[model samples]
Target: MTTPSERAARGREARKRVPRSSHGRWIPSAQRPDPLVVLEREAQDRLPELVPLRYGRMAVSAFAFLRGSAAVMAADLAAQRHTGLTVQLCGDAHLLNFGVYASPERTLLFDVNDFDETLPGPFEWDVKRLAASVAVAAFQNGSTKAKAHRAALVATESYRTTMRSLAKLGELDVWYQRIAADDLLPLVRGDERARVADRIARARRRTSLQAFNKLTETDASGARRIVEDPPLLERIPDIDRVTLGKIFSDYRSSLPEERRLLLDRYRYVDAARKVVGVGSVGTRCFVLLLEGRDDGDPLMLQIKEAGRSVLEPYLPATAYDHQGRRVVCGQRLTQAASDIFLGWMTGPEQRHFYWRQLRDMKGSAEVETMSPDTLRTYARLCGRALARAHARSGDRIAIAGYLGTSDVFDRAVADFSLAYAGQNADDYAALGAAIAAGMVTAAPGA
Candidate 1:
């Protein structure tokens, strides 16, 4: 086998053939798939009734449109020339997808929060997606084009710098490194720091018990169950009690033996179809409530349906037979410390599903209301967190060598983000036109 030093040397050499500046080019092909058509096809197998809600959410703004159109971006990225260095990609690594959540130790950790579309692909793909999201989000928040470009630049530069630093560390050291909220607060100043601290406070209160209290209530007979509220939260009809029991039992079997034993203490009480996230709105996601010891003690687990990743068509198929297992494994590999109850199983009719805490001190950046300076700080934090994730499965030394210690790759990626932001705007307009022409329906104010 080649030595580690030799591998990094080869990676540095590869960058010479495909100069970093070459990545700046973005000329769309006439053969590029229509964003609306691609989106419609993606929604084909999803719950038909909730499909309109998905479009409605995407129709809200250009940034919202970009958030839900991961497959469209994946197809476009596949058309671009990429370095063959693959990593565990947060395939939809948009700005809003990065967030703060509690690690197993109950510490506030910042990392990529979504892995529904995760897969192994070119490392640059995640960087590109994240950078473009910063541009798009900045513009949506009424920042100047220059500010948007700056955000992308900050993101790229931070990723490059952090990855290079991590590359110098031993493998075990890199694995143990984590970005906590306290570590991030110092990067901001005054109001931004105050804002992050407040957000952290809010997230700490967003635990399973909070959700249980807010979403469930007791009946006259003294039994507790989740309360339904229209299209967003409703009970699944026609599911027999035995089938429900089997589903919960099968999901428990997917957990670790110790977790299974711990789970046995809780009795399953209720499950509801709970719509969540802009991209995941139409999927079959359930909020399962389990009672532990007494009515006051509760656990809420989200069993989200897992489909083939958005990158599946562009990349090779996953080795895992079940898509849920694919998602669970990818989450474990990419996250610093995933939920203890994280597991996966194939449910009735072979629909794959992954299970995790429904809510556990989880909080996302409020990008919409962020000032330009705050946005810049957030962009860099996300980039650093993303670099850590990539380093987990990717060859960090080789990647760091390929990136080099300069702003060439940063400038190139920022330029590409600006260009792709234009494409995203065009796609957003087309969706709006489709909605206006009666080809699609969107909820008012959505």
Candidate 2:
């Protein structure tokens, strides 16, 4: 058996052997399939599997499902991976998924906030998804195609530059340093700088206590309660509810003794169903309200449905044996700071993801509403964050070498974005056709 050092060396050599694409090569549009058709097929497959977890008021529209269809898009795109060793990807590293959240240390940090589809795969798969998202967002905001193209180019170039820089840094330096919200203010245009500052300040005020307040309330009996509504939110099934209640106890037992002791101080006050996010619709998600000492002292925890990563089945060799564990492990690996309560459990009812302090000072720039300069600033920041994430899991030197100090990769991504955005539009159209043909029932306002 090879020693660990030898194994690492072999991995590095394999990465070095991967070929790089030449600049100015023409990749025809016809070579790509319609994105909507791909999306519809995925939606159809997932819809049946989602039956057990469809909470009331959840987003069931074709559009809602399409938002969560990154897995489908990823599989299609991975089939076209041309060059570069596939690194573990954020799978859904779109602009919107990049946002601000409090670290375990209570410092507000900006980084990728979602990783349901994360897996080891081609690096350009991420670049292409991000670029396509930029184009779609710009188009939605009524920006001209040229503006969208420019924004994509700037973002890709930032990724290239940052990856190269990180490749030269020591591991400790790369891991300890991150681009914070404050670091982005100066990069914005003069007119938008004030708004960005104000946003950051507002974000700073968000805390765990504040999140508890927003998501919880007291009933007539003065017991803590989680607010709920139909289709959007409802009580979990009795079987699932009972199973989850027992699992929470097991989860507490699984924590470090100190944390378990801290958790014992709180009483389970109430549980209610909640629907969250455009892409995460139809997944079993619940909010548990816990009370400590008095009714006034509250804690909120979310148990989200964790499923197999979309990238797993496609890239079978690199896929984790357990999808839920992959999510927990991937989140910890990629985020600079993660939730202390972050953990996973598999029960007979379903696999559940446990996390704490939802909506704590969480804020994202409205990329759709951004002016050109603000968009540039946001793009660069996300690019840097993406590079930082990739560096953590792969050999940065080889990636940097593949990128070099040139516009070749930038221009290639920009060209790919233009081509792929058209693909997404076509996919969106196919979803519309499926809805029109009565093939699938779409949720309202999806």
Candidate 3:
């Protein structure tokens, strides 16, 4: 392994090869693919009936469009020059992707919660995606262009400062660092701290029992089962008890020995196909309700089908053959504390799938209704979290040296984010046009 001093020297040299100001540039490729065409390609493998729903969600707003267009951005980012400083990336690191969830120890921890498009890629790609999301979200919330740009700047600066701080820490120290609820409240004051506290309180109530009570009930046969709601949550056709038993057995075997033993105590009750999130709307996702010792004791798990990451084409090939294992391994690598039940398996037809708690106190910032002050604070927190995640897998000293003790890179990223935010609006408009032309079928705001 290279010494920290040597890494710093290499990072400084990297600055000369790709100056910070160059990061601000966003020249679209002359042959850039149509956004609608890219969306069509992405939907080809998805469920035909649910593809329209994905378009419906993305049609909501430019910010929504940006959220669902990870593949489009990945293609664009691939066209840009990079510093070659790579990390295990959350390919879709939008503001909404950072959330508070329970760690293995049941402690409240805030970190990146989505890993659908995760892969090893240039560190700035993640930072730039995050900054741009802040700008786009602010604009969607009726903030001025200046305020939107400021949010991006705040996010970039926070990431830079956090990376620099991490560079000075020992490897193990940096690896062990985490942003729990207790560690975060002290960083803010008054309303900001109160907001964090409220979010924490709400997250505490969002558990398996809460979900079970709200989504399942005792049927006429005296057996508890999940309720079905058409178009969103419905039972798969022809799937019976024998098939479910096998599925659960395979999933249980995928877990760690201890976790498998723990899961063995529970009996599967019901499963419903559930649609979730903007980007994941068309993917095959299911909610499984399990009963432990009694009807009051319940556990809910999500079994979501995993496809190739958006970054797969641009980044080096992943070592894992199963996409479910790719998502699980990537989540474990980036998060300091991951879900204890997190595991993956391959289903029929070679489809990869991963399982985890359906909702374990998962709470995200309500970006749509955030005040400018709250947005800025949230952006900073996201930056800090992203920096720590990158530092765990990438060379922190090198990245910090490249950024230096200045705001040049920060301002550059802000500028890039603002530019990309505009492009997102244009892309959203194009999607609307496609729907109008009958080229894409959607329910608009569904």
Error of 1 at 328 (Å): 0.6
Q: In model 1, where do residues sit more than 4 Å from their true spots?
A: 237-241
lDDT of 2 by residue, 25-60 (tens): 334445555554554444443334443232111233
Candidate 1 per-residue lDDT, tens place, 208-230, comes to: 99999899988898888789987
Clashes of 3: 0
- Error (Å) of candidate 2 at residue 46 is 6.2
Candidates' lDDT values, in order?
0.90, 0.67, 0.90
Best by TM-score: 1
Better of 1 and 2 by TM-score: 1
Summed backbone clashes in each candidate are 0, 8, 0
The candidate 2 region of ten consecutive residues with least summed lDDT is 54-63
TM-score of 3: 0.97
Residue pairs in collision within model 3: none
